[model samples]
Target: MKITNVEFVISAVRPDQYPVDALPEFALAGRSNVGKSSLINRMINRKGLARTSAQPGKTQQLNYYRVNDQVYLVDFPGYGYAKVSKVQRQQFGQMIETFLNDREPLRMVLLIIDIRHEPSKDDILMYDWLKHYEIPVCVVTTKADKIPRSKWDKHVKMIKTSLGFHPADRHVLFSSETGLGRDELWALINTTIEEAKAEAAEAHEAEEAEETAEVSLEK
Candidate 1:
């Protein structure tokens, strides 16, 4: 995707406040301080559009960023922050679950993980939950620049093994500092959006056909 117009749309805590444009949305989920903000900046070729905070669990709502007026990058509240209160964590969980289960425009989720560490228990749980729900997901390993190129494959393998990564899901090794996986991630996003559009179209055709059949029988 070419670099173009991007805007910070909203920080929404409720479904009623979400963007109504119905653009294809790719949600980003990760542990606190996992370089998700940096990844978003790198993806859109911006320096600080998605604000990076030194504090963990700073993002408490779904942050919406509209890209090229064509699609959305929805940033979920960072999970697995030990410092966050139990009530807050539970609230975040409910908010995320609702969106994942009911949001119609969601195309895919980019589950961000730090490449330097093994997948956390929270990471494994989130991945499994997405799998159980049959939601499309792409595992994005961030901060790749911290690891030597030689060790990249080994670390990736370890992470995948820990998470029991799905065979059909995509994984992108990313370095927000170097823009290593930006293009590949965008390609995956574009492909997913197209697939969703096709599915919707097919469903619409099937619905119309059924309606027409009922009309004919009534006549």
Candidate 2:
């Protein structure tokens, strides 16, 4: 996670447009105006790499950003924007669901929420979907700088309660403005990638062992 080359790869609306590099990707998901772009920018140490839009639901595509040429941060379209038409929202949901369910390179997802408020209905639904899929996730509560330190624990508890967050799931308090939890988030991402690789390796070994046993029996 050293600071190096950061590039805006593509705005992909379909899997065909997704990057073919096979790099492990961390998908960022959250409601509109929840600071997903700002968190990406902060992680890359860039001021405006990920554009912070004043308009909610402005990003209708999966914006892929390559960090250090190693991992891609896939920013999904922010949900819960009231101005969007029902049809458009349905389309977005299908697009997101397809990626979450089918994307092979997706290692984990970072679901962002505001620290000062209870988790919205949209947030809870997203969390539930991820859990149902057994997708690796890290819940990021942003805007921690706006809240006082003493009350941070209280808000975190409220968020966990509202989302019914699993105790095993990782939760990081973040502040894009202050760089809080940036390092921790990066560490968590790297750890997730490593764990996924280990799991895949174990599965491959098991498959090979099974094949060997079958061959021996045939012999």
Shift in Å, residue 155, candidate 2: 0.7
Clashing pairs in 2: none
TM-score of each: 0.97, 0.96
**Alpha-carbon lDDT of model 1:** 0.95
Give the runs in model 2 whose Cα sits over 4 Å from its true position: none
lDDT of 1 by residue, 1-219 (tens): 997799999999999999999999999999999988999999999999999999999999999999999999999999999999999999999999999999999988999999999999999999999999999999999999998999999999999999999888999999999999999999999998888889899999999999999999999
TM-score for candidate 2, please give it: 0.96
Best by TM-score: 1
Summarize candidate 2's per-residue lDDT along 1-219 as a digit string, tens digits.
688899999999989999999999999999998999999999999999999999999999999999888899999999999999999999999999999999999998999999999988999999999999999889999999998999999999999999999999999999999999999999998888798889999999999999999999999
In model 1, how large is the Cα lDDT of residue 6? Answer: 99
